[model samples]
Target: MKVVCSYCHRLLRESPGEAVGVSHGMCPECDAYFAKLWGGLKLGEYLDLLPVPVMVVDGGGRVVAASERLADVLHRPRAELRGLRCGEAMACSRSRLPGGCGKAEHCRECTIRRTVDEVHETGRSVAGARAWVKTDAGRVPVTISARPAQGFVEVTLDEPEALAGALGGHAPPSRR
Candidate 1:
């Protein structure tokens, strides 16, 4: 098979094969070029372009990137939200406890943490998992969806009522 650069149409390599065919793939040059181009964009900046409230959580469940929509809902600056655990970012009451964030006992049963962890562990997506995040204001009901993206998980938050209505009045399944 002959491997050719999909972007520049440059011949990359040829391998022994019974079938004569061309495989389209990005060459090192094109890959580096695009990587450099995209590398110019900050994670938060790229995530802010998303329409919905979304956040990128690293393996440690830290908020590595957050969209402007999420920041607005959290009432915090996007830059400040970075490096915070999901619980802290969402203002979960347990996060304020002595151990803080994931260290608290309630962290084990936390839907948001569990959903994100499940997606990371199983490499499967969790959609519309209902969760009640206890904040300083009160217990706020929300629906969370998470998908593994590269080495990070992109978690989206939506209003429970809004998601329920979108799902034909049926609440999404709990992914405990």
Candidate 2:
């Protein structure tokens, strides 16, 4: 597989198989430019280069950081998404109950929650985990991959369209 900088279209390298993890790789020149643009390349900058909805969640499943794609998918400002729990941001029906977020029974079976928990607990990367999220319209199926990054876990989604379909062609409602 060929890897290129998603921002500058510079060729990075070619891999024999699929590129794992969150990076699309960056050339040295674009790297230097982005470093100055963002006051040094940050997690968000790397996330912005990804073509999927990805976020960095803390130990408790709170979104400590996210890409603009995640912000757009959730239909919330990037700043507002920072503190929302992963389930809440995705509008998981179980998360709306009194128990909230991770406390509900459905959460026990949630792949995203499980992957996040595993990464936080063991500091290992999880890939190609299929997650079914319950929403108002239907069950949304998505493929997720996660890796421990910095002090937070980097989570990426491969099926935003399936998630959109599950949400009935709309972004999930903002947290209350």
Best by TM-score: 2
TM-score of 1: 0.67
lDDT of each: 0.80, 0.81
**All candidates: CA RMSD in angstroms?**
9.4, 9.4
Query: Please, what are the lDDT tens digits per residue for candidate 1 over residues 40-129?
Result: 977776776566678999977999889877776676788899999998887777899998987899889889989988998988999899
Checking candidate 1 for backbone clashes, the offending pairs are: none
Per-residue lDDT of candidate 2, residues 108-150 (tens digit): 8888899999999999999999988888877778788999987
Top model by lDDT, which number? 2
- Alpha carbon lDDT at 34, candidate 1: 79
- What RMSD value applies to candidate 2? 9.4
Instruction: Tell me the RMSD of model 1 versus the true structure.
Output: 9.4
